[model samples]
Structure formats: structure tokens, C-alpha cells
Target: MTVNRRFTLAARPQGLPKDSDFLLTQDIVPPLQEGEFLIRNHYASIDPAIRGWLEPGGNYMPPVPIGDAVRASTIGVVELSRHPDFTAGQWVMGLNKVEDYSIGRGDGFTQPIDVDAVPSPTAYLSVAGAVGLTAWFGVEDVMQPAAGQTVLVSGAAGAVGSLVGQLAKRRGARVVGIAGGAEKCARLIDRYGFDQAIDYRGKDVEALSADIAAACPDGVHFVYENVGGACLDAALLNLAQGALVVICGLISEYNSAPQGARNIWQLLVKTATMRGYLISQYLDRFPEGVTAMAKLAGEGAIVYDEHVEDGIDNALPAMLRLFDGSNQGKMILKLI
Candidate 1:
């Protein structure tokens, strides 16, 4: 008998999740039935979106049921398979749980991955993964920043925001990023090549808005918003006429009660448009996104960072890095 260790949601989190909110449990791995496969999970993708799912109603997906392994996207090798498509030793990626082993049925989110096509297997969890795809589609499809337009990105140093800035810049747009600290802001300019970077460390909404206005003196044409709350309010104050705002993720309110957008009325004043974006809506086009991102990454046309924490024991701590702004880039938990 195989014993599987699972990280389960023990209680509904209040504000940011704590260790007590989750439980580490051990269970026996049952024998595979027909059309079933077992995966030895090697990595888990730690994302801010997971915070939303911990809520009672959740955002998109249903709330993760209590006492079950926490839902997450994972990459692993098929250890055993009774499914026709999935075979032993094949690498796969999908929406799985945070556990040592996952059972797959060759349907839904499960899909095979060609490790040779990427620089690394973990790349599927970062640059060529969900966040990368989100950045690609958000900038190219939704934002569609034009040459000479001023594009503003919130949470600029994060996994998706960093890519958003770079992709918009490639379209000839002047990109400005908002990050937490001076270090991240400097990286936005020196490393990611943003036209300007604002440190929102101690600034209030009014102060941040003023800084945004100064950076985009002509007003911002496109806003790629990842962090909501003050960031969204500040961006709203600097919107150009006919500006487009794409809401990607709201990390600020994910851990707490929503404050709602205070300056959303700026849309009326500026005659601007704002739309919520979910990457799952583009699932049919993931192949297209992966191909494009892979080519750019392979040619050194794009760069990305992954902050990988080894061992499943570190999953909670690794996830906390995102909310605290301690993560260098994309967060990943190396379970293997």
C-alpha cells in the first residue's frame, strides 16, 4: 500500500491563511481502477488566485471542500496508468491537488507535456504556464496596446505583471509599472525595460495617483491591473480618454474583506472601459499562447524568474511570499 500525504484545507481562512487553517494528512493510495492514472507530483504552482478559492463562494471554481487536498495546478510524471491515453513515465500538467500523488482520468484539466520543448519541466508551471499565458492573452488580445500609447501595469514585478509590461513594450507602447519596493521598481526599469516604475511602498492612493500622472503625463491609455485596491484606484485617476482597463488579479483584497474600487467612477469621467479577464476563458487558445511564448523565450526575446521552494512542507510559506511581496518572481513548490 502507498501512503499519500495531502495538504488539506482544515478551516475557512480569516484574512491571510495561517498554518492552523490547513492540515497535513496521510492516506493510503487506492489501486487504480479502469480509465485511471496515478501521478507522482513533482511541482505545485503557488498563485494568488488560490487565495480566492479559499473563500466560501470562491471566484471562478467552487470553493475547495474542507478536509480535501487543496486544489492547485501541478506537474508530475505518470507513475501508473490504466487510462488509454496517459501512460507510465509521461510528464503531465493539470489542475490537481497539493499532494504527493494525484489520480487522473485522462479528461478535464489533465494533459501531457513535452519536457524537451521547454527549457525545463518547471517552465510549464511558469513562463509557458498559466501566468505566462495570462500575460500573453491579456496584453495581446484584451489590452491591445498601440504604438505611442502609455500602458500602466500594477504589481509590475510579479509573475504575470512583469510579462505584461514587456509584451506591451514590444508593441511600442510606453510602459510604466507599479511595485512595492524600490528594488522591485528598479528591476522593472533596468531589467524588464519599463519606461517608468513607481514604488507604492508608503504612498496612499492620492500619492500613488499623482505619481502615475507624472509618469504618464499624457494619461494612461491601457491599464493592466493585477493588484486591485489602491493600485486600481490610482490607475483610475490617471486614465486617458477612451482608456481600457483589464482586471487580471486582485492580490490586495484576496486575503481580506474587499474594499471595492473607490475611483471606479473615473470610468464615467474618462469614458474609459474596464473588463474582468479570466485566463480560463482562453483555454481553447492555450496552444497558441504556449507556442508564441516558447519561441520568444527560446530566442532570448523574453525573460522570466521562478522562485522555487523545495519540498511540500514549504508550500504554505512559499505561498505567503506572494502576499508579502517577498517572492522574486513566479512561485513554485518543488514537491519531488
Candidate 2:
């Protein structure tokens, strides 16, 4: 009998989830039913969006039921199959639980991956996965920043924000990124080729807005927002005449009660548009996004960082890194 160890939601998190909120439990893996397949999970994608799913009123997806395995994206090899589309030994990536094994019915984000396509199978969870695809669609389909436009990205050192800045730069836009510290700010300008970088630490909306005005003398033409609160407020205060703000994720407010944007009024004053963007909206075009990202990655046109934690036992700590701003890049758990 296969023993499956899972990180289950022990309790609903009050604020920045504590270690008590999750419990590691084990259970026997049941036999594969007709049209079902079993996967031996190797890597688990630790994303900020998962934080929203823990709340009683979840965003997009339903709240993960208490006592169930916390929902996450995982990459693993098929260990058993009763489904025709998947066979044993094939590597797959999909929306699954953080566990030793996952049962799939070949639906909802489950797909096979070619390990040789990138540097590592984990790339599928970073550059070639949802993070990269989100950046791709957000830039190409939504923002569509033109040459000479100033594109501002918040949480610019993170997985999706970093890629968004790079993609905007490729489109001939001058990209300015806002990160937390001097180190990340330096990386934005030096490593990621950002035209300028703003360190949002210890700065209020007014101060940050002044800095943004200085960097983008004309005004910010486009905003790829990941961090909300003061970052979004500051960006709003410096928008160009017809700016477009894409709300990707609000990492700052995810763990606590919403401190809504105070400068949202600037949107109306600037005749700007602020739209909430969900990656699922572009699911039909995922293949196109993946192919494009893979090409750019293969040509060394793009660069990304992956901070992998060695074991599932370290899942809670690894996830905490996202909220504390300690994670270097896309956070992944090496479950195997």
C-alpha cells in the first residue's frame, strides 16, 4: 500500500498563516479508478494565490475544505494509470495538492511536459508555467505597451513581475520596477535591464509617488501591478493621460484585511483604466504563451530565478518566505 503524506489545512489562518494552520498527515493511497491516474509528485509550486484559497471566502477557486490537502500546482511522474491519455512513467504538471501522490482524471490543468525543453522540469513551474504565461498574456494581450511608453511593474523582483518587466522592455517600452530593497532594486536595473528601479521600503504613497514622478518624468503609461496598497496607490498618482493598470496580485494585502488603494481616485482624474486580471482568462491561448516563453528562454532572451526548498516538511517555512519578502524567486518545493 502506498502511504501518501499530505500537508492539510488544519485551521483557517487569521493573519499571516502560522505553523498551526497546517498539519502533515498520512493516508493510504487508494486504487486508481477508471479514467484516473496516479502521480508521484516531485515538485510543488508555492504561490501567493494559494493564500487567498485559505480564506473562508476564497478568490476564484472555492476555499480549500478544512482537513483536506492544501491545493497547489505540482509536477510529477505518473506512477499508475487507468486513463488512456496518460501512461505510467510520463512526467506531468497540473493543479494538484501538495502531497506524495495525486490522483488525476485528466482534467483541469493537467498536462504532460517534455523535460528536455528547458533547463529543468521545475522550469515548467516558473518561466514556462503559470507565472510566465501570466506575464505573456498580461503584456501581449492586455497592456500591449508600445515603444517609448513607460511601463511600471510592482513586485518587480518576483516571479511574474520580473518577467513582466522584461517583456515590456522587449516591446521597446522603458520599464521601471518597484521592489522592496536596494539589492532587488539593483537587480532590476542591472540584471533585468529595467530602465529604473524604486525601492518601496519605508516610503509612504506620497514619497513613492514623488520618486515615480522623478523617474517617469512624462508619467507612467502602463502599470503591471502585483503588490497592492502603497505601491498601487503611488502608481496611480503618477499615471499618464490614458494609463492602463493591470491588477495581477495583491501580495501585500493577501494575508490581512484589505487596506484598499487610497489613490484610486487618480484613475478617474487621469482617465485611466484599472482592470483585474486572472490568468485563467487566457487559458485557451496557453499553448501560444508557452511556445513563446520557451523560445525566448531557449534563446537566452529571458532570465528567471527559482528558490527551491528541499522537502515537503519545509513547506510551511517555504511558503512563509513569500509573505516575508525573503524568497529570492519563484518558490518551489522539492517534494521527492
Best by lDDT: 2
Over the full model, what C-alpha lDDT does candidate 2 score relative to the true structure? 0.93
lDDT of 1 at 5: 91
Regions more than 4 Å wrong, model 1: none
RMSD of each: 1.0, 0.8
Instruction: Estimate, for each residue in 193-312, the C-alpha lDDT of model 2 and write its tens digit.
Output: 999999999999999999999999999999999999999999999999989999999999998889878888888899999999888898788788887897788788999899999998
Q: Taking the tens digit of each residue's C-alpha lDDT, what string does model 1 give over 33-92?
A: 999999999999999999888889978999999999899989999999999999999999
Candidate 1: worst-modelled 10 consecutive residues by lDDT: 106-115
Instruction: Tell me, by TM-score, which candidate is best.
Output: 2
